[model samples]
Target: MNKEDVSFEIFPPDFVLEPYHVFRKNALANRNRTESQEVDHDMDILYQFWSHFLVRNFNAQMYNEFRSLALDDDFSTRNASTGLHRLIQFYGASLSRNSVMPDQVVRDLVDLIRDEATTRAEHVAFYLLRSAWRSGSLDPRNREKIDSVLDAHMTAELEK
Candidate 1:
């Protein structure tokens, strides 16, 4: 992402932004050699990592900007695609009967994307929740909370 475009916005060090910046990379990378790829795979992973941290810190500007970027059709599917694949699989096992992703893990991840419910990028919270539900990994105690979150998201969308 270009620093000039986001010059109006707050930013961390260049090294930090290199992996997670998404605001102004050339929308058409192949079309423009001068432009950096719109979405960086490393950036996606970093974003997902930050998403976890954002759960506690909750920076509206940063979160909103990144999430808005994530909603785009070209936000790099690998953000949601490859990220946390090995991590989750290792921690929670596969989505099969022996799957071990904790209910709270599922719940928190769902909550992670509560504001941007429809995004398919970086951590793919919706998909994670679905996989847990299908695998019977989610505990009954947190089911209502997850449902409520999704229900509220749907309601907001319908109203919009």
Candidate 2:
């Protein structure tokens, strides 16, 4: 994805504190990433933190980094699955940027899922990503452009 293709908006400075930017936000995101044990208050905080940290500052470069990390040849199934969940959660929170991801990204995600997904957790993450991205990325307004590549991975699984 190119800079011109970035659809998410740049966040305002008031939303982030310089002293605790990456460390603080990452801690929050990693903390809330789960399915069970949610109260309304916690969900609200989760939504707020997600929007504040990820959706507002989302861009092609971030997507590229995620793509590179997840598609890394030796990325473990656990990593791929967890990574895909993170991507989907980002997608769910950004209801306005449905088509931001490229087709190849979708294919890469799917290819990785099919190839590396061995655990139920991994499959669950893939299922959610597929469902959310395919349905709309939480945005019913714009059409999403996601696809999958079946069979063996195009590139050989590189040595770690």
Candidate 3:
């Protein structure tokens, strides 16, 4: 989670005008809204916005922040899972677009999914592994470890 670990220096002068800032603002507003008034429509839009933004921007700090928010137990499970799903999709797209995320960020994401052991987390881990394979960012040994975790998840699901 160190700021220095990720490259935020690639941002151009016009970054302030980017739609991500607008999404961020809306997402924050949604976070503070009362449960009775909150709507999934706004959350869905925010998730979509984040997915598109991350694919283009690929800032580790932003990614970490998004992941932390999504994984926070205080948030509704639906929102958290939706956020994580969008993030996993973003990671795949970003990798295919030739934008490399930091190693630590990837590792952290994988570890989080493994530790959480939810079906949604397993799906996220699968996407992460696919992205890693496509991007060639992970060493074979590490990849095997991730694959093993995914296999275990799948096995557990089948058993249930």
Query: Largest lDDT belongs to which candidate?
Result: 3
TM-scores vs. true structure, each candidate: 0.34, 0.38, 0.53
As a whole number from 0 to 100, the lDDT of residue 83 in candidate 3 is 62
lDDT of 3 by residue, 48-140 (tens): 766787667666777767666655622344344666666666656654454445566556656655565653434555545555666576566
Candidate achieving the largest TM-score: 3
For candidate 3, the per-residue lDDT at 16 reads 41
User: What stretches of model 3 exceed 4 Å from their correct place?
Assistant: 1-23, 34-39, 73-80, 95-99, 116-124, 127-160
TM-score of 1: 0.34
The residue-by-residue lDDT of candidate 2 on 1-160, one tens digit each, is 7745864467663554334456445644653464433323332343444433555665555566554433341134323234444555654454345435445445555555555465444464355554554454444432233322443332222110
Misplaced by over 4 Å in model 1 are 1-49, 73-126, 134-142, 149-160
Indicate the residue-level lDDT of 19 in model 1: 31
For 1-160, candidate 1 gives per-residue lDDT tens digits of 6766566445545635333335234322322332233445554554555455544454556545544444332334323332233233322332333323345444544555563444434544445556666656656555544565466554343234
- In candidate 1, residue 119 scores what lDDT? 44
What is the Cα-based lDDT of residue 22 in candidate 1?
A: 53
Summing lDDT over every window of 10 consecutive residues in candidate 2, give the lowest-scoring window: 151-160
Q: Model 3 Cα displacement at 39 (Å)?
A: 5.8
lDDT of each: 0.44, 0.44, 0.58
